[model samples]
Target: MQKKSCGFFSRASELQRAPFINLPLHTGRAPAYLVRRMIRMSHAMSKVIIDEYGQVEFLRRLSDPLWFQAFGCVLGFDWHSSGVTTVVSGVLKQALKLDVHGISIAGGKGKKSTSAKTDILLLAENFGLSSAKIDSLLYANRMAAKVDTAAVQDGYSLYHHVILFDKCGNWAVVQQGMNAENGMARRYHWFSDNVQNFVREPHTGIISEKKNPCALDMTAAQSQENQKVCVDLAKSDTNNLKSSVYRLAARDTLDRWLGGDMVVDVVNTSGYEMPRRLDWALFKRIYDVQPGSYEELLSIPGVGGATVRALSLIAELIYGAKASWSDPVKYSFAHGGKDGVPYPIARKVYDESIRYLYGAIEGAEIEREERTDALKKLASFTTRMFPGQ
Candidate 1:
C-alpha cells in the first residue's frame, strides 16, 4: 500500500480525498533467500525505529502507505507489487520482537484473517491490556475490515487484512482487496489517530491505480446527509422499510425511478442493479438499537453492502438524499513500479529507503560481517532497480 501525491486529484473540498491506484496482481512468492534476509533486516530496522522514536511513532510510520511501501522496497520485494502488503506484514508478524518492542501484529491473508480476534486477545493478554480496551481494539479491527469491504464497494474483494498495535493501544490496519476480473488490487489503510468516526471517512489512506467506475463510497464526507437518511430509515418502521426495499428491488420500480429506458440500457451494459432482498431482520435489530449515528447503524451485525446500498437508494428515491457514488480513488498507489505499470521504479525514493536501513543495520549490535552482507544485498537490489543509476 502506498500514498500517491495529492497532485493526481487536487481538490479543495473538505473531504481531502486521497488517490487509490489499482495495482494489478502479479503472481509468485517472495524468494526464500530474500524472505530470510527481509525478516532479519526488518527486525533490526524496526528495533532501531522503536528504540529511537518509541512504539507509537513506529506504528505511525507503518500506517503511512508510502513509508510502508519503502519498507517493502528495503526488504527486496517488488517495490510496486501487491505482495508487498501481505509479505511485508507477514514478515513483520514473524520478525518483530514483540516482548522486547512492546508491540504486536495480528491477522493476515485468507484463513489467517479469521483468527484476528483471537490473536488480538492473546496479544492483549501479553500486554496486560484491560478487557474493555481489548474489546475496543477488536471492534476497530473488525469494523475497519467491514467498512472497506461492505461500505465501500469498488469491485474488489478483500483477501488480506492485518492490524498492528502497541501496549498503549495505538493501532493501525493495513488491508488489501482484489478484483479478480481485472487482476487489480486496492489497499485500504486505517490509523487510530485519524479515526474520529468508524463509518465516516475513517481511513487514513485509500490506494488504487485507477478509479473504479460506479463504485459507491458510503464513507465519503459527501455521504454525510445520505448516511443520516439511512440511519433514519433504519429507525423507521421495519414494515415500511421492507416495502421501500421491495419497491427498489422490483425491476418495474427501478425502470420508473431511472426514467424507464435509460435504466435498462445502463443495467444491461454496466451490470448495475439494486439488491433483490433486504435483511428485514437486520433492520429490526437496527430499529431496536435506534442507533444515533450512521457509524452505530453500520456497526450492527448483518448490516452489509446490500443493506447499506438499499437504504442509500431508498433514501435517494423517497427523501431525495443522494449518496456519493464517485469512487474515492483518483489514480494508482505511489512511488514506483516493479513492471512499471504506472511508471518506472522511483530511484530516489528506493535509494533513500536503502540508505536509511543500511544505517540502522550498521548501528545495531549485530555482527559486523552481517551488516556488511546486508549493505551488499541492498547494493545489489539498487543495481537491479536501476541498471544505469
Candidate 2:
C-alpha cells in the first residue's frame, strides 16, 4: 500500500463518539449453502439502503462497527465470530453490482486483499473516475492500513482489508487483524466521511475483546507531541538519534528515566524496551526524505510498527514527550446493553437500523422460507442482545 495525502472528513468529534463491537476468531470456512443465502440477503438489503439513503449513507452505516456486526447477524452469519468481517465483506463484494448500485468493494481476505489497487482500477473505470480521485481512494486505503498496523501497535497483524466506495469517491474500510498467540481478531473501521486526520484518532471504530494494556497508540491525541518529536528526530542527524538509542539501550532499565522506582519486570520492560536494533538504512531514507509530519513519516515505504515503537521510545525518554500506551478500543465484546455494561445502546438509532433491515428482508425477492428463517435469526439475535426486551 503506497501512501499519498487525501482529503478526509472533518467530523472528529462524531467519529470519536462511534461505537465498537468485538468478534472472536473462529476456524473453518462458512458452509457454501449459507454463503449463497448471505449474498442474496446482502444484495437486497444493500439495494434498499442505497436506494433509500443514497450511497454516502450506506457507506456511513457500514463504517459503524455496531451496525456492521448487526447486519452480519441479520444475514445469518455467526454473530460473534471473526468471520463476520470477511464473510460479510465478501458477500457484499459479490452482491453489489456497480451498474446497479453505484458502489463497489475492492480487496478481500488473505492474498485477495493485496489486489485492492488493481481491483479499484478496474472497478472505477465503470464510474468514469478521474486519476486524482482514484489516487485519493488508494491513499485512503493504504493510510488506513498503515495507521492501524503501525500507528496503533495493539499486536494484531492485519490479514483482511477491503475498501467500499461509490462513484462519488466516498469510501469506508473494513479490515481485520489477528493475534495468533491469543487466537483473537480485531476489526478496524474507517469512513472517508468521518475522518479529518489520518494520524490522530482517525478510526470510525475499532472492535476487539482483548485490550492490550501496554499497546503503543501513537494516534492518540496525547501522542501529538511525541509524533512531532518523532518527526524531528527523523529529520535530525541519524548519528545523534543512534547515540540516544544506544544510551537508552545501555541502561538495563528505563525505570529511572520514566521517573519512578517501578519494578523493572519482564512485562513492563517488554512495553518500553528500545528495539534491540534500529533499521539504520530506513532511518537514512527517512532523513533524506525529511518528512515534515508524522503522517508523512508513517507513509514512508519501510516504516512499520517496530520502527514507530523505537521512535516513540526515543521521543519519550530523550525528548520527554510521552506517547500514550493506552489501548484505543472504546468498547469490548458485544455491543453494550440497556444497562450500559460497556456502554448504553442508542436505542432509537438501533431500532431504526433494525426496522430498515427488517423491512428490506421482507421486501427481498428470496424464497418465503428463506425470508422466514432470516427474520427468525434476526429476532434471535435481538433477544440475545437484549434479553427480555
Candidate 3:
C-alpha cells in the first residue's frame, strides 16, 4: 500500500487536515546566479519579516510548509521541486547571519548535519542561553530527526536537515530525505511551539508530492491505542515479545494467526515476511530500561523501524490494538481554504502574511521592477492555491 501511494503522486481529501512532508523530485544544483540572487532576496525578506512581525513570527512562517514553499517560489525556485528545501535552507544559512538577523540556521545537507550540535552550542553561547536550555534545544534537534527517520517507516532516508532558531530559544526544523529506488525526496517541518508530543502529531506540516498509503504512521491519532500497547510490550519480558516474533517467522504460525482472508493485507502492508528474525539482543536492552512511553521507546538507540513495526504488529494481532494504516495527507497552504474544508481562511491572517513578504521585498535592495515582480509572483501563488470567493 505504501508502494502504491509512493509510486505516484495522488490527491488526498482536503478535509482531513493532517500534516505531511512535501515530497517532490528534481535533481541537480540550482545555478550559481539563481542561488546568489536567492540569498540576497531571502536575506532582505528575513529582515523585513523580523522587523515587522518580530522574530517568533518569522520562525513560525518558516515552519509553515505552504509559506516556506511560496517563499522558495518567490525567490524564483521551482515551486514543486525538491531542491526548494535544500536551496532555501542553504541560502538562509549563508544569508541570515545571527549577528545581523538575531536568528541562525544550523546544519545543512548530508555531512553538514552532524555539525548541528556544535553550531547550536556556539549560538547558545553567543545568545547567553544557559547550559540546560542549550542542552534541551540540542536534544530536541536529535529527537526530531530520529523520530522521522526511524519511527516513521516511510522508505525515505533523511540526508538534509537544518534547524533555524532565534536567540530567544524558539526553533524550527526543515529536513529532507531521499528514497533511493524512486529518486523522490520528502521534506518534514517542525516548530517548537507546535510540538506537544514528539512521538505523536509533532510536525508543523509534512508536504510530500506523493502520499504513502501503507506508511506506518505511529504518530497518527488512531494509532494511540497501539502506541500504548507498544509501550506495555516494551516493558514486559523480552521473552514474550521474542516468542511473538518467533511465531511470525514460521509461515504456518503466521498463516494460522492471520487466517486465510487477513494474510494478504497484513503481509503486504506490514512487510511481515521480510524481517525474518527479531533482534532479541536489542529487545533485551529495551527490556532493561523499561521505557514508560512510546516516545521514550523511540528515543532509545537501536529502536529502528523494524523493531517498532514488529512491536506494533504484535500489539495489534495479539493484543487487538491496531495501528493506523491510513495515510495522513492534508493539502493545505498558508491561509488554508476559504470554503473551510480544513479551516476557513481569516482575512487578517492572510493579510499579515502578505504584509510581511511584501514589506521584505519593498525593503530589499532590488530595483523597483524586481520588487513589483516579486509581489506579483506571491499574489499569483496565493490565488492559484486558494481561489477567492
Candidate 4:
C-alpha cells in the first residue's frame, strides 16, 4: 500500500488548522552582495580551526543506509512495528527497487531503557559472527545476558543520534551510545567503561544462552503467535511491559512520522545565515545574519536563525516555500507564505533559537576565525541552494 503522512500537528486544538500551510514561493537566485559579504567574512576569519577525523567518521557511519534499516528492526525486532525498518525499505524499493523484509524487535521499553549499542552488535553477531566470541566478550565484561541468540540472528543494523521530542515530559529522547569499540572484542577497553555514560541501562530481556530454536525462532506462524503473546502481555499491564510491547508503541509513533501520518514541528528552522559555532578560519566565513533576514525570523518565540536558514533552504530547494517582503532575497527569510508555513517563518520561534544558538556556540569548541569562515560557507551554500531568488 502507498503509505500516508503522519499526524503530529493535526491533533487536539490544532485540528481546525491545516495540516500544512503554504510556504509561499520566492523568485530569483542568490545575490552577489551576499556572496561578497560571505567572502569578506571568510577573510576575516582566516585563522583558528582544527579538524577531527574521528568525529567525521562517526557522523559518516551513522548516516549509512544499511545501518539505519537494521536499526529499526533491532530496536523493535518484530513484524508490526516495522516503521523504522520500512523507512529504509521504502528508500531501498526506490533505489534498488528490490523487495525486502525487515524483522522487528520491540517491547514496552522507553527510549531511555533501550541500549542500541549492545543490541545492534547482537544483531550483527546473529548475522554470522560467532557467538562464542560474543559470549567471551560479554563474559569478560561480567555483563549479564540481555541478548538472546534469536535477537542476534534477527537484527543487524542500527541508527545513532535520532532525536525524539516528548511534548508531555518535555525531554529529549535520543539513542546516546554509538561507540565503534562496542562490537569489537579485541579493541574492548580494559579499565574504562562506556556504559556509565550510555543513555540507559543495558537491556535485560535477551537471554544470553541459546534456548530451544523452536521457541526462540519466532517466524511465520510462530511470529503471529509472538504478536498475540505481546498483545496479551500488554493487557496484563505490569510495572514493566514486555520488551515487545514497548518496542511496538515506540515504532508505531516513529512510523506514524515516517508515513507522514504525524507532523513533526521542526525545531531546527531557517538558518538564514551560516552557523558561527566553528572558528571562522577553518570554515572560512564570517557571515552573520543578513540585516533583517535572521532577526526578523529570530524575533519569534522559538524560532532561531538556524531554523530560519534551514526553512528557507528547504522552502527554496525542496518545497519552494517563499518568504515575504520586497526586501532583497538577502534581506528576507524567503518570499512570505500566504499561510506562513515555513517562510516569514514563525517569528516567535526564530529569535528564541538565535539566543539559544549563541549560547551553544559560545560553549562550542571553535575559534572565532574558524567560526566566521564556517558561516561564510553556510551562506554560500544557502545562496546557491536558493539561486535566482
Q: What is the C-alpha lDDT of each candidate?
A: 0.73, 0.79, 0.75, 0.25
Per-residue C-alpha lDDT of model 4 across residues 139-211, encoded as one tens digit per residue: 3222211211111122212222221111111111112111133221000011112132111222211111111
Error of 4 at 122 (Å): 19
For model 3, how does the per-residue alpha-carbon lDDT over 301-347 read when each residue is reduced to its tens digit? 88887778878888887678988776554443445455654455556
Question: Considering TM-score, where higher is better, how would the candidates rank from best to worst?
Answer: 2, 3, 1, 4
| Shift in Å, residue 28, candidate 4 | 35
In order of lDDT, best first, we have 2, 3, 1, 4
Candidate 3: TM-score? 0.85
- Write candidate 1's Cα lDDT for 1-389 as tens digits: 22333213333341122222225697878889888988887888888878877888778677666567656776667766888899999999988877767789999998998789999998889889988889889999989988987889888898899999888789999999998887778888888987988877787667666665688889988888999999998999987876675455463533422332112111111244566455556677789999999888888888888788778877876677877888875332244534453466665655545555666667666667767765665665555433444
Please list the Cα RMSD from the true structure of every candidate, rounded to 1 decimal place. Answer: 6.9, 7.6, 6.4, 26.4
TM-score-wise, the better of 1 and 4 is 1
The worst-scoring run of ten residues by lDDT in candidate 3 lies at: 1-10
Q: Look at candidate 2 and tell me the lDDT of residue 285.
A: 90
Root mean square deviation (Cα) for candidate 1: 6.9
Q: What are the clashing pairs of model 2?
A: none
What's the lDDT for residue 193 in model 1?
82
Task: Let me know the TM-score candidate 2 reaches against the reference structure.
Answer: 0.88
Q: Candidate 1 at 277: error in angstroms?
A: 2.3
TM-score for every candidate vs. truth? Answer: 0.80, 0.88, 0.85, 0.20
Candidate 2 C-alpha lDDT tens digits along 194-305: 7888998888777776667688899999999999999999999888877676566565454333222221111124446444445677888999999989999999998988
